[model samples]
Target chain A: MDRLLVVRCPDLLDEDEDGTALRSFVEVVDAVEAYCPWITAVRPGLCSLPARGPARYFGGEDALIRSIVGATSDITPVEVGVADGLFAAVLAARRGLVVPPGGTPDFLAPLPVGILGNPGLAELLARLGIRTLGDFAALPASHVLGRFGADGVTCHRVAGGRSGELAELRQPLARRRVDEQRGGGRPGGAPRRATVVDEPGFWGGVGDTDVRAGRSLAAVQDLLGPDGVVTARLQGGRGPAQRARFVTWNAREPQEDSTLGAPWPGQIPPPAPVVVHPTPLRAELVDARGEPVRVSGRCLLATAPGRLSVEEAPWAEVTAWAGPWPSDERWWSRSRRKSARMQAVAGAEAYLLLVERGRWWVEATYG
Target chain B: MFVASPDRRDVDAPPPGPSPRRSLDRERDLASLAVLAERTRPVSSSQTRLLPVVPPLADLLPDGGLRRGSTVVVTGLAGGGPEGSGGGISVALALLAAASGTGSWCALVGLPGLGAVAAHDLGIDLARSAVVPRPGAAWAEVTAVLIEGVDLVMLCPPFPPRPAMARRLVARARERRSVLVVVPGRAGWPEHPDLHLGVSDMRWDGAGTGEGYLSGRRMTVTATGRRSAARPRHRHLWLPSATGAVAEDATGTGTAG
Candidate 1:
């Protein structure tokens, strides 16, 4: 008997966040190995490594499968199937076989047409009302080849338990979960399994809320592919709605754009809605005065660094400089400051400033 | 000077022939002759020189390349001879074509009558070029502006300039690296130019009895001031010949005629 262990992962997409789901699957494989000390050999995925050695080491087909299934139950919920060939083993596993041996053909006979890799073949078979693998196997190979080409002949062979190929298993380095014991063991010296406890205590120091707007800026950067631009408007405070605008350039894609209020400890600002667009050559930024501010950086820095500014705070580094013109205030209001403004192009946006008291101060930045 | 005839009887009869009108007419003729002499005074070779159309011809000139931006004083004779020829339009076109082809923008100031369209007909694309017209004697201002940013400037002074002013403008042109082609009307230009071209005997291309439809009259081009190792060669160019004109033994040296 060939004891074939088929492990199926129910959720693949959830693994993208981190390797949690894959780690869970690895734990189950470790348990099986622990129980069956005489299990001969173990393989990871069936499609990757040669199965000949394991098949021969277990002595015969029937005994190998029984030993594998018996050990597997100690670990996780897995269906064990055994067969003479690779296709038979896989089909038997999918049919929910607990202990299948020499029943490979019967196991595969009534399986759906979808099991074959080719959808066109499955559709054609379904249209002909050939609901079982037996019906496909019954067709003459030459006639099927004449109608559907060489793939049809291969499918016909697979439908029967006569596929000459063995399962190719890809073996990964044996990973023992923290809770599982390692194989090839001397019992007394076994390492203690480390369990990852997902408790609130695990996340103790790391705050739950992101108080600074850096998180939002990071999101926006991701959405804009490399060489993108962003223009933003920031408005806050209780008094007559102060507004600031800024433009940033050369942003990377899949970014998140958000805004947060001043970074006060223990207070997290809600992330503003992110707006994304294809990359632009330049962007603009503004402040409550609707003027642009300049941003400067060291040229040696290859990537764009994120920027955040406080309302009414002055920025000293000037990247670009413009003006010495006096604004006419009598045309508008006597209270307005008739000063010279400088425009600065900064990372992710532009900053504006008004020169006063022999010092430069930020007026606006592109949002 | 009196031409006394051997027959003295006629002397006494003519001695009585002193009509006031004739004397007056003679005085008027002498005054007119003095005026004509002043108008047609031949400028000394040292006073001004005509440069050649191209720089390579500068070596062929006594002075290098029309004094490098000095005014070229062209003098036209009342009739006949090299000075009598009128090819200012052709000369202007050729100079412009050569300068602009070498990536220099030329400005023609003050001569609005110098049709850019005619320049186009002569193979100069003036559209990509500029022409500014100023009234009165603003050649100095125009010349200053041309030398500032432009590569070549053709300034037609409202009134004939003094010899010193012309020399100064030429010097300025050199400093500015501009080619200043001053029309002959300006006075007191430099004599030594890179190239001096004298044109004469211009005739219509197709006229008179000709053996073929395209046959044209021949013209004479003389190179008198060329200083290059190559001896200045003059040629008679048939305007409508299949090969146009031949010069310097079959080399076609003076085709611009």
Candidate 2:
């Protein structure tokens, strides 16, 4: 989970037919972008940006939040808060609290389960006398899977502060509305035509191939919306997912590898995994006795793993294995994570498994 | 196939009748004209028809490169789970590496969170590559749209295509002179491609029980195809060497990790 700073505007949460609220939200985004260039328009009234970089530049997270609130308040009442993930950060913004870096679990512990937004799960939990997120988080993950299912397991992870995202929290149409507002009043509901390929090379002359590709890609954006087509830009980070960022593809701006060569300590040696999952898949690694294998406090494997099963699929024999390489990221902050990565090979396939808080996840695959 | 070199500068250029230029200047003009002709020639020429592939993979292709306007299916073991492909995706990415590095545009459809670092290390030029990670129900349409302009379009269809849908895409690629590389993970392709590369015997090296890091993988790829590539051919390769680039593994002994 990223340390995200969310900006929530109460006045502009809903949109009117005249598009007044959306336009105002776009202005709010522009204002926030001036402080941090990479802010995401998560929804009509909600937006977020990674707080770590800007906090460093602006002296501290407190100052960063204060400045943003001060700036955006000129347009509308804005709430600013920083926490470990989008879900928590949004909650923090609503309450105007800056939860400490590693303190999300504590901050979220006392909250009602209703905040998770799954009415069915929340209702079911209430019936079982699990009224708060703390109670929900205390349930053993394996038990949650059998009784409540996958989505319940995800909510449990979120409640426990092991994960920070919930798919239900987002409005899918919000991003396109923001893009439409920024692109200057393109009608909200119209599907853009393929022939409306107006993006040309802003630098120098465009090639014939570029133009043709642009037209087709623009057509795809029309079909899948602007965020469908994307181009990856490599950046410096330890984890494979962190090493590259995917930005929605735009024909007007050509992609560049400007952030390619920065040093990252404790980075794993290549060959990198061919497929890095956006959201890691749950995995099970157990020893010969059928007991779960875990990384000890001393960072050594508690036992030899015998079989590996990913996403509840059929188990396969673990032919070869390596490391419990301790990746203690953000060690200086409250949000610091002490997870370990290991490579496990199952006949014909290899997987990069991550263990954090006694749970295993298949982070990437060498396909 | 008819060659379509449409240069007419020779006919349009001024005749050598009215004014006489210095011999050196005339020679320079002709040299520049030749360069221009080379630059403007259609890419569909007989010799330039094939897109370059890494040397190790070239021997498997009948044309020693990806022949333009051809469909190639890279297949891995069946029942290879959603995440498992028995190294089929690696082979497909390797095929794009050489072509993309040479400035050809490539688009990947239905591949989410592309390990771009892996692609970059494999010598792929990411700036020219476009990824449509999740095309959902519109995958065929998305692949078809991209095939119109992209030099190579790799499709990992989210679902098995009907024979007609498969034929249309294959025909579209043929007509557009685009290379279609399909990694039919489980949802199989209905049509036989121009070349079919099957991956088997996959093994990772340089790792033991809590010992070394994953340095590389050795796999056997068997290429069988139509016409010129009728005979099946198999080659052993380090699909991703220590540095994440493909290399020929001359030593047939694929040591297990």
Candidate 3:
């Protein structure tokens, strides 16, 4: 009840900081998560893990504290603090000290109110002759409410170093572990290490959007399960949106040296269609005699398409048509997909048809 | 040099003894506090801020620009308009330019054709805009996230949201004070939006023969506000002028009569 383990990684925000720093921090976080199930990320550089469970395993509080410092010493210097609650623990971590048991309130009383993290409240408190946490805690609850409704209640509670939300946070961790068990992973046991990285939304490398293609975005949300919304981050590749991917939901940087970044040896056709199927649909592009139209190796149409029929619909007369544009992509790579795209119109509907692997298919509808 | 502790209620002042003047001062302080709270109440609780659209297309809106926390349903009119056209996207993106220019973020949910290149070309800050082109059944969830963080979120949910889900999203957008542009697709449409925009008289210009390159198009955009008494206002806009940017047709066609 009177111990907290604060993990600190300095140089996290240094201009030269890179993935090395992040990786090291995640390693420290992961190592702690292996022992303690409940953790609160204080900031990018600091995190607080409850020591109640780990202290028993290591035999004592001091033993648990030493283990944490000892575990991360090789990677980089980390400062650890053990105190009554989050407020005192964070303060002690900065000073590299451990407050004695039942002394958190006394330790917090002398500290300035700036530690509460509310700058405007701190400024108002300073102007109200409350310089230290002790002075802040002395103010009448009613007076604080009259001045600053709900917000003042929190500052007053924290200034007194009282145990707050952290006591309730443990319940959720235990619940999640039980929930994890239903997934058929070591059922009914101590839930596996509960790390933030393992959290459903916390980590995403969502790349392809298959469901979005060829159907409504919500049509197949059930298909992707927890990944939920799959967005394409146009990476440093460019053939079409189908191939242009990098994997963050928001990608704006124009990928350099993309395939046919400018016009390659051949002429680049017009801009892409509005809707493109993530997966092309099988279809037939026939000439007047109903024979499948073919594109020669020289990228010329052997026979003009007289009619088009999509798998969803029967033979529709040609309203209008354009293109036979050849798309020879990544021919240098081991896996290459080459296709000829044609923009065709039929009965007020426009379609982007593809001819790949010597078979014709409807790629997307422009309408 | 200090006279009589210039302000008696100052932080450094000694605890006060009972005095009529001090009591009156406290009352005045309470009165001012009440006034300050009234003046600076949280915006969404009472009124919402407005999102400013680009100037050239401003007149097309009932308000001078797009109003925040309100949904604008945009679609192409079947009669007297280019049928099965992509003009709605142009109008929506045009509405986006002003907000994105000033660094406000815009998110596109389940709406495809969010071509980053095209958005950038139309004066949108590509880095600030997030595109969830296919959010699937998570349309409401995805839109909620964007609406919470971004100034404007454009959602083209394939099916009209169920009444319950639509109500929830509408409330969320209003609570967050962000604009939601809903272009409902085949399945259905959301509940009535605050503003309705119909694109009519859309025609491609600048391409005369087989020789000249494709330039831009002109569209008569009409806006009717559901909550306002102002009559529907229409303006002919070059959604993308020859320069590929939205410009109000000041020199071309006149405003709607």
Candidate 4:
């Protein structure tokens, strides 16, 4: 059995963006392949691909088409039409038909002359009182040849359910993959190993690494595929000496890296994953100058999926004195929230705390 | 006592009627005064109503601007007659421009080769325009659809309509309050129009030696039929400076019915 399927976007003309439509078409085609291996998508403005290989692999033509149709409907709106030739299949699909084999000639015979697309031919055929394909096929070959030349002969052949010359399809090339190494060591004294994968068609692969470091991201991209994402964390260091951890999407574990003052030139390796939001803190402090004062403190917060939050302390005590300085902050617009902060200075250090989601968390300290 | 009696007798004798010439003189004076007043008042000037053409031509046509829902038959001269130079583009533009001014959408029914770009150059916004080609045996059906919604419908027939179809379309236009502008190959149409205008070429000054613009030309617009009689004054007009072509008063002799 021979079967044909036509896939079309009903509102293709009305769509404003071409990229969106192309993406949608690709997704639908991918969905179709999930069930049926015999399916081939017909790209607009290109020659059709032969279904013979897929048809044989899938057992039979009918099962192949049915599987394809079922899978396609799961993702997008699609219609299927089956016929002997591509031309007949497209027309049948447009007219919403599922024609049986050897039925093309009889089916096309009664269609209007206008549907033929050639106005001159339609007018001439109408003048001769020939209204249907059956009538045109019944005429003597020589007479039709005399009237319409080569085109008439071709039309006659097409009407008689004969195949014409088909075009050859070409295959696409394969993709290459690349891997890159991270810093000399791991961050936070944690055991870590990070590798970066940069390859064409590799999507959504940002392993673990602190991406905020000045030049670590640039180093990672240089080492891995030219387009690599790094997520990382920093620990056990102050300011510039802070330890950074990172990972590439393909990497197994986060890699710890260190940047003393500035990042090293050349290929910057990927780092380890650093928690985007840090825990909030509150503290009481005494002034180093020996004056009795109350100070509240706050720190930045981090959350999953790489988001940051800020919270301030509500109250704090300093040098045996306590005071309430409530904090109210909203970062809904910028996706960050922190308001008034209370700081307490105790001896030589200042401690900070934050209240988030109605619970207080130890935030940070400054020495 | 004797002196008083003589005065009373004189008073009774003097009770007499006035002269007949006096009454005649009064009636003659009133008649001449009426005639003088009638002669001094200028003849009542007729009121000119706007004729409905396409929306753009509203300003060009005398008031009574294209009767809403009436048909304007646009006739083109055969061969290269003096009137047929621009094809039908000029008249079509004029109508479309007028319709556009009123914020009305115009549909070109059965005219396939109408150059939308050229139409735009002539100041017809095709963005707000729709063209239906051939329209097949359902031309009337399509026309009815446009007539019901569109402000103006322009039709260039593949074949002249039979009387019945023409009458039906005209009635439909009236019912829908749409102005139907028919571009006719020849002058005659079976049905009479509310106003008939025959357009012919007119002479004008050439473009300025240095200036970029072409000086306006004068056109001989002959207005006939019953509608024209009320405002029968006809004169040459300079094509106005506006891109849509408004008619400006020109130095010409007037012919009034």
lDDT by residue (A32-64, candidate 2, tens digit) is 987887777777899889899999999999999
Please report how far candidate 2 places residue B121 from its true position, in Å: 0.9
Candidate 1 scores an fnat of 0.00
B9-33 in candidate 1: lDDT tens per residue? Answer: 2222322238987676666655655
Model 2 quality (TM-score):
0.60
Cα distance off (Å), candidate 2, residue A321:
1.0
In candidate 4, what are the lDDT values of residues A82-201, reduced to their tens digit? Answer: 566665666666665667767877776676655555567768988999877777767765465446643454455455555321111111110010001122332665431221222221
The true-versus-predicted C-alpha distance at residue A317 of model 2, in Å, is: 0.7
- Model 3 B-chain TM: 0.75
Model 3 agreement with the true structure over A38-131: per-residue lDDT tens digits: 7655545567887777888998777877888887777778887778877678778778877887788898899898877778988998888889
Score candidate 4 by lDDT: 0.42
Candidate 3 C-alpha lDDT tens digits along B54-119: 876777666666777888878754421112334666677778888767545566777554544445
Interface RMSD of each: 36.3, 8.0, 10.9, 37.8
Model 1 lDDT at residue A270: 17
Pick by DockQ: which candidate is best?
Answer: 2
User: How many clashing residue pairs appear in each of the predictions shown?
Assistant: 78, 4, 5, 73
Candidate 2, A131: how far from true, in Å? 64
The best candidate by lDDT is 2
Clashes of 3: 5
Model 2 collision count: 4
